[model samples]
Target chain A: MDFLTVIQLLDSTVRLATPLLLACLAGLFSERAGIFDIGLEGKMLAAAFFSAAVAALTGSVWIGLLAGIGASVALSLLHGLASITFRGNQLISGVAINFLAAGLTVLIAQDWFSQGGRTPSLMGGARFEPITLPFADALADVPVVGPVYAELISGHSVLVYLAFLTVPVTWWVLFRTRFGLRLRAVGENPAAVDTAGVSVIGLRYAAVVICGVLCGIAGAYLSTALQAGFVKDMSAGRGFIALAALIFAKWRPWHALYATLLFGLFGALETRQDVITAVIGIKVQGQVLGALPYVMTVIILAGFVGKAIPPRAGGEPYVKER
Target chain B: MDVVPKWAEVILVPLISLMLAAILSALVILAIGEDPVAAVNLMITGALGSTYGWGYTLYYATNFLFTGLAVSVAFHAGLFNIGGEGQAMLGGLGVALACLLVPWPHWTIALLAATVAAGLFGAAWAAIPAFLQARRGSHIVITTIMFNFIAAAVLNYVLVNLMRPAGSMDPATARFPEAVHLPTLHDILGVVGIEFSKSAPANVTFLIAILACVLVWLLLWRTWLGYEIRSYGKSESAAKYAGISPFAITMIAMLISGGLAGMMAINNVMGEAERLVLNAVEGAGFIGIAVALMGRNHPFGVFLAAILFGFLYQGGAELALWTSIPRELIVVIQALIILFTGALDNMVRMPLERLFLMIRRGNA
Candidate 1:
């Protein structure tokens, strides 16, 4: 392969990996705080659904993105109320919330929009326009890597930049900050954190909200940036993939980046199945390709790489006995 | 006002949680641009509108009933076996293959073979996670969910590409023979000149579901193996302390759960479809979570909870038809049931204990 093709392929892979990268970080934060946020799917779906709806309504992409984040944050609050405040089982509540989101989206979409859930496509606000880096055009004049630098490396959404920035930001926050210490402590021993008089509830709540915001962006990216207009069940188990990434990364932010990128590659393959098939002359159907990532996740999780030992108290809610 | 005693706590908490959930559902309806009261009324009327309505509800109900039992069996063994989707899918596929392959005149053999196929396939599907957990100490939830995806994909590919009947263009499998079909109990009811609607496929699947419930109860409470399984489910360490092999018990528990889930295919393919045809397995396996929870892992309770879900499903469909309300109210309702069942379990248990304590005090 030419150097140009390699750079171009690599560039496209980055744009594709952004959403998974963001969502995986969200999972990393929540799980590290010992909250197994299974409702990531619900949060993502709700955000995607709301963002698409609001964007289509107002014809403003920013408003839609904000709405998506708000919806996901609200879902996080619900998770906090049930699992944290009330000491409910995180997994069950998360799963329940996901089902509610799935059902509610379909119900509301049918009742309001009536297009079998493909909301009216927005011309402007419905999507994020790809951005070209300032120096990339000039850099593209370089031999071999020139076209690759301009097209693959440069043309991407703002979130693509944010996704890369988030890795170091997350690492610094989790390791450097006092709040990060508290969060990590809580994951290890909430009772001890409670003993130290740092409010476990407050820290966990903040972690959950942050997780929600990440999921919201992930959702918005899936709909507006990746493919415009909300598709029914559009998260398409990406949240679960994020969860798998978190496990694979051992709840570390930087490790999660690589894990998510791997998953993103799987997803890109799944989406580009026709291309893969055409190039290889393989006669695999669309559905088989679609199921590939899930298959990989299972094989990986089933002790192929290693056992997924979650945060010590992950999924166990803390209730103060006064 | 009287002080709420312990024994009544269990029942009261669930009652209150259910009411709260209902109110929340109403809010949800309002939020979705529908009249909650009218929508709910429609749900009731639609589910039980006529004998025909009752049939469809029962047919759907039987799916939950078997799925519920599948979940409940694992609950008894103290493992969250979430592979019901795959297990049930394989079950349906197994039944379809048997019905297609077994060319026989006898209705009994055809039905038996098909059901047996479902049970065995379900067992295999469940065994994947069970073996992983029992032998490798792998997490059941992840393995099962993965298995579900694989099962769904494989089943769809087979249905669309390989096993699908030649003449049908649709993504479905070969049609089952008429003889293997589950006979409707409504037909039997009509023998006494009792009238019911013709559209209803209210078949012997309901009875089969009920019988499975009874068998589960017997298997759990009556048999020593059931006792051992329950003990194992409660705690691996405790069960081991009591000399039970958690490995063997987990496998057995998972097999029964998967097997019963497979039996639920009777409702979907043979009982309802009149032949073994393919449609993607709906989220009934996941619904098994809510069913198992509402039933609180009890056989009779699971059976009753399934019927309740059936009621909600039928009513939700009806509401969708009558009003502008979407039919997913039932899905929300089921989700709420799961939420409430989990959240309010302690409250319910506490009230029951208090009630029992007060009753004891009064008796003394």
Candidate 2:
């Protein structure tokens, strides 16, 4: 492929990877703290709808972002209430959250906007605009690195950069901070952490809340930044993909970045299925191409790839006496 | 040790949870600028009022029964098989292939062949995930969820490119031969001198679902294999120690689950649509999860839950057709029911447990 084509593919990869990265990081926090949250999809959907609805109404992306976060956090707390406080099945609660979000988003959208379960398309300040980095124009005509620097690295929305920045921040917070130590400990051995005088439930709640915030940003990035408004089930299966990436990454932040980027590359390639088939001189159907990520994850999880071990206490609610 | 009576534990908790979910759903209706009482009245009248309504409700219930049984079977083996959606999709393909490829003399012969075909197809789809979970230690939940998406893509491709009749604009297969068509509920009821609606979709498959429930009850309670499966579910390590093969139980349970899920196609495809459509499975596979949960993983309970969900579905359709309440809200209502009965169950149970304990102590 030409350098320009390569740069474009890389650009597409970046755009596609942003939401996955944010959601992956969200999963990282929740799972690391011992709460297995499969409702990342639900939370993202809720955020996407609320963000788009608020953005279109108020014409301010910032306020829309906050509303998105609030909606996501509210659902996250509900998950916590069911799984943590009530000691219910985590997976079932997650599934319920997903259903609630799918239905609530459309129901509210239809009620408020009367637009067939879709928010009005945002314009101007209501949507995220791409920012051109300094020297991008000046270096546009330079040698091989110029296009790479200008097209591939520059001209992304603020959330794209923030998503990338989260990897290192997450690594530091999960490895270096006192809170991180307790969070990790709680996942691995909540009894030990509790014996060490830490409040296990409190730490888990914090992790879930952080997860909600990150998922909020991911959803906002989709509706406000990627598209102008929310559509029903628009988050689609990306939240599940993020969970797969979380497992594929072995529950680490740096690995999440790599895994999400890889998945993003798969998504980018999915859009170019015919091109790939033509270039490779092979017969590949779009449906088969679209199923690559899922197929690959199953293969990996089936021990074709390396082992993936989740936290020991994950999926189990903390019981003090037990 | 059992402060709450078994009847209350089995029946009252779920009933109360259902009431709670109903109250919350009514509030949501009120919030949407609709009269909750009217909506409730409409739903009852729409889902259960007449022979036609009952026909549609029972048709939907038939689909749920299959999927619900699928989930409950897996639940008994302690496997959370969420791939019912995918399994049912493949089953649709099985039904289509059976009806399209062969010239069966009658519906009975065709039904038998399709049932076997669908069962095998669904079981094959589930085998990989079950094997991975049992042998490779991969989590079945994630794998099954992924398979659901893959199943959709597969069904979409088949319907668009393979199944569609020549020059047809729609992405659906041609109608199945009339010989393969199952008898409708109206026909069977008429033979028995009972009046019924002619246009309702409920068919012989509803009877098949009831038969399945009885069979499942027998398999779970009266068989040694059922004992093995249940013991393994209760404690895998203990089962291992007792010489019950984990791999065998996992595979058997999942195969049965997938087969049950696949049988839903007999009702949806052969009975109602009479042709394979791209989204024939719709979201009934996911709805099965809620059904299994509300049913408490029992066959009879699943039957009751399926009927309840069927009511919600038909009533929701009526609301969508007549009122401004969108169909999507029904999903939210279903989710709330699942949340209360499945996940937030302890919120009600804990308080009731405490109350029962206090009563017992006072008596003591």
Separate clash counts for every candidate: 19, 0
Worst 10 residues of 2 chain B by lDDT: B1-10
Top-scoring candidate (DockQ): 2
Docking class of 1: medium
Tens-digit lDDT track of model 2 for B95-124 = 999999999999999999998888888888
Candidate 2: clashing residue pairs, number: 0
Which candidate wins on lDDT? 2
How does model 1 score on DockQ?
0.59
Which parts of model 1 are misplaced by more than 4 Å? A1-12, A274-288, A319-322, B1-10, B274-278, B344-364
Show model 2 residue runs off by greater than 4 Å: none
lDDT of 1 by residue, B1-364 (tens): 3355534444566566677678889898888777887876777777787787788788778898888889889988878777888899999988778777777687667767777888999998898789888876666876787788778778878878898678888778666766676668678678888787776777877887888889999999999999999888788899999999988998999999999888778778877775544453588888888888877788887877788788887887778677766666778887787787875455445565677678878999
